[model samples]
Target: MLGFFKRDKNKIAKDGEDHTVDSMDLLGEKAETTGKEVKTKLHFPPNVEIGQEERYYYQFLNNELPLLKENQISLSGIEVHSAEDGTVSVKAFLRNSLPKGVRIAEPITLLLLGPDEDVLARQEFNLTGLGELPAESSTPWVYVFNAKNVRVKEIPQTDWKLAFELKKAKGPHTLDLEESWEKSLADTDKEKLEQLVKTIKPPKPGEVNFMGIQSRLDDAGALHVTLLIRNGSEKNVKLEQLPLNVEDASGEVVAKGAFKMEALEIKANTSKPWTFIFPKELVLKEDADLSKWKAYVPQG
Candidate 1:
């Protein structure tokens, strides 16, 4: 009887060891399968070639040039008169051809460059003091410079060009008005705007959380995006006009637009779904991979 009990106990131990080994094998197989699935689902976007000059030009076009073109604002009658006493008086007329409704919030920067394109002196002229630029009107801006304060061997007597740029003000919740004015934007302007928008990733509001992003090609060969947004705020929030930019894995802007949601309001601590359909023309690259694209929301 003692031998029989001992043999039964040994049999039970063997069975237990076999079961444990089988279970480990099954788990290992599952882990390997899951890894393969994840690898298959991952996608990468194509690489793009962009030079530094092209990048800077794109930024200028998007940030400063848009408003000037849209409002038909021009710098004319520029006169630079210098005296023997090292005093330079620069005068220019800013003409606005478009009707009123736009405000130039920042100062217009004028750079006096030498023949070799080296900046000799710089000046900023504020337009906000004059209030909104009226239609078919002209405003005079005068900048006086003392030669001692200038940073050049000598101011160019001839063959000089006045370079104009807008100085951007930095602060929280600052929105680029030029970007918002897209009614008269050209294709090239739109492209530059898309690129500029990609670089501006404002801090997401504490109450908002982006959950996931998915995309698929529709029947018309257009890409459709499904975004999961969660509102963690105590009060309900609206996402009807949420501006978003879609970027590839390489961090290039692929497409950008405001998202429209059927259910605009999201309850507190709840998630909502938003869909966007992008046409082929909206894509920046001809052979862009939608699988690796992500949507980014710019916060105010």
Candidate 2:
């Protein structure tokens, strides 16, 4: 019952192609391609009950756009709006080529990049609002990157691109960036995260691993331990609770605790860091050698 205007296939940017989007571009259906840009106006069905904006989008997806092949999904950035406060919003389309309908209810990351493929902003979103997507159909949404979300010191006003920054979406050791942690990362911290992926071992199937990064003793003698929680499983997992043991270089239990979590999602094949504080009462040894340390689930 939805509709969209047909998109010019040639107009869609492919890899190594120019992807700058602007209002000047035509959104017409292609009837005959005789080696020229054609803006064929197609009549709309009277039965469509959606808004004019949605009607145009459906026209783009159903008639103007080419049929999607097997297992192919396409995302196109149609518009970009930048605010004086450095906040940006991008309107994009998500299309699927599957034979059957598809539904997604998970957290997804959106990456905005420059013409040279440098990252500009990274933001996380929930797919609950996407609803159900029919096969060979597209849905449009606006992704906003507020000042806190933008990562670069300079933002090119034009010629920007959009992409999904999935945990497993990108190949090995590229960037283990999740928006929550990414915002707090310093230049040195980012370099460390990039390097860690290369050296971090792959987690076993259906398992999550917590690798120790560093630990410190506060003035009050509480131990704060930072760890990288890496997920190597084929599926995304959520953690609701955590019972941990912190061991020293000599395999001595220096810190131990059970902590509650807010249903944290450890996306497939991504590594994220978190810190755990062991109160002075939970610290078994005040003088534990923490030069080399590790964390794990305490065996019964």
Candidate 3:
């Protein structure tokens, strides 16, 4: 037979005030506390056990640190950001009115996944030296850590999963994040867009136009992209320098090739499709199980 474990209420009050009582049980016993308009909170110590999806809360008994009458628990949100240096920044908010005795086992953990949900990176943090917080306020805690061989991790086609744990037994844990990049839209495609614009007919009015493009299906499952370049001008335009570039979804260069049309004579309204065979290595592997490949302007 197991016995009930009861805790005594701790009080925090201004000078002299009327007192009330409330009781709380740890495993399964009823505790009591005495105070007027008492507010309770609970907090987990840094050594408390936490899961991949939970948070810790604090409670008050009468006016003291350890709540003997009630147990209050809640969840907190986690935010993760990826940096250009192949590192990640993690941030979480801690409540001010946390119980002094409550313990936390783990701070945070990150799981990196491949295109098919295959885990490629896993990391952990041992949160340290967290004490009492200010009244009705939250403190933002952050950590910046590097990932090993992040080149493969930066492939952009890969998928990632993140998890967090608040406590091993009691839980209000949550895992969430807002992904952001420091670079701008133009910066994302500056190189490739530059190369692509170079292929355009010198910005001459109606001198050249991007007609259409398609991929040629080869037997070996290789891709051959065909781009149409049209001479819409009345003059015999010399297609000497055909600037072209190709990129994958994550602003990464995948393939690049160019062609030169003979001093072609286009009285008006003429077009040609240049075929480009994508290298197998540059394409996403079958093992990745990606249904479609995204396109970006190829780099020179």
Candidate 4:
């Protein structure tokens, strides 16, 4: 047999916690006398598993008539006026007894259906403790929104359908948080290793004014090379003080030379130029070529 509408047995018990109020037992209309106060009490079913040690956000939605004149709502927490046995006093005036299984600290949302099946008002509320006391001097557990602000509008006497909904929030991510901490330490270690390696490196070779071999042969096989060097340092770095080297694809030094400059201040973001040419004997079309060669600019 297939069931058209099936309910989760676990969720059924949870839903029972939100709908503890009985409308018939509560007041049908506003109180007549000013300064007159009424007390309402609610209870939960036995053997229900409602948590109490944590805070939960809640709102009370009234869709039938305007619960509040304006949209302003606030719920602090339920105050205990008095308590004994398994009953407690709530300041809200109700015309009926509340439904069983209403536990404290659970998030609850109220939905009131408007005319033509429209949703009039939707609000959330949270309960925070067990209502198992009947003491008259006690207060209801704190509700987040202002109950006085919630009221029915003065339209006309019409029946409104109401229901409640509930949901929970997801917990924090712990695994990713741990990985972030490890990655941070790894970056710091890499930086330290770079500094240590640079400290023991040899100083660059002295600079030469102009080191290049101008070939008279234009055999397409002749080495045609151009090098533009920049001294990216704050101090004045002369070509005579630069330890420069050029290596081809075979790790062979195609040209290693230095140069001289007019004691130029290699101010930050500035650089000089260097041009080098290889001998025709070391230059080749396949086995030897400057195209695969490279220049290394050591960091000071």
For TM-score, the strongest prediction is 2
What residue pairs are clashing in model 1? none
Instruction: Provide the overall lDDT of each model, using Cα atoms, as 2-decimal numbers.
Output: 0.48, 0.65, 0.38, 0.32
Worst 10 residues of 3 by lDDT: 1-10
Superposed on all Cα atoms, model 4 deviates from the true structure by an RMSD in Å of: 27.2
- lDDT (Cα, tens digit) per residue for candidate 4, span 1-300: 011123233321111112223222121222222332333323222344433421111111111111221111112111111222222122221112222222234455654433444544456654444343232112223222233323433211133334343332322211111233345546665454334323432223332122222212246434445433332332334443444455576777655444354453332323223334445554433344444666554345
Model 3's alpha-carbon lDDT is 0.38
What's the TM-score of every candidate structure?
Answer: 0.30, 0.44, 0.24, 0.21
- Winner by TM-score between candidate 3 and candidate 2: 2
Error of 3 at 65 (Å): 99
Q: How many clashes would you count in candidate 2?
A: 12
Evaluation by lDDT, superior candidate among 1 and 2: 2
Q: 1-300, model 1: which lDDT tens digit per residue?
A: 001111222221111000011111211111111111100110111232444653443233223321332224454323455667776655444444443433566565666666677777776656565465454344444466667656765565455555564423323322122232445557785565445434545335446755335776666656677665655454567665667777776778777676565546666544444567777666565555765778878657
RMSD of 2: 12.2
Order by lDDT, highest first: 2, 1, 3, 4
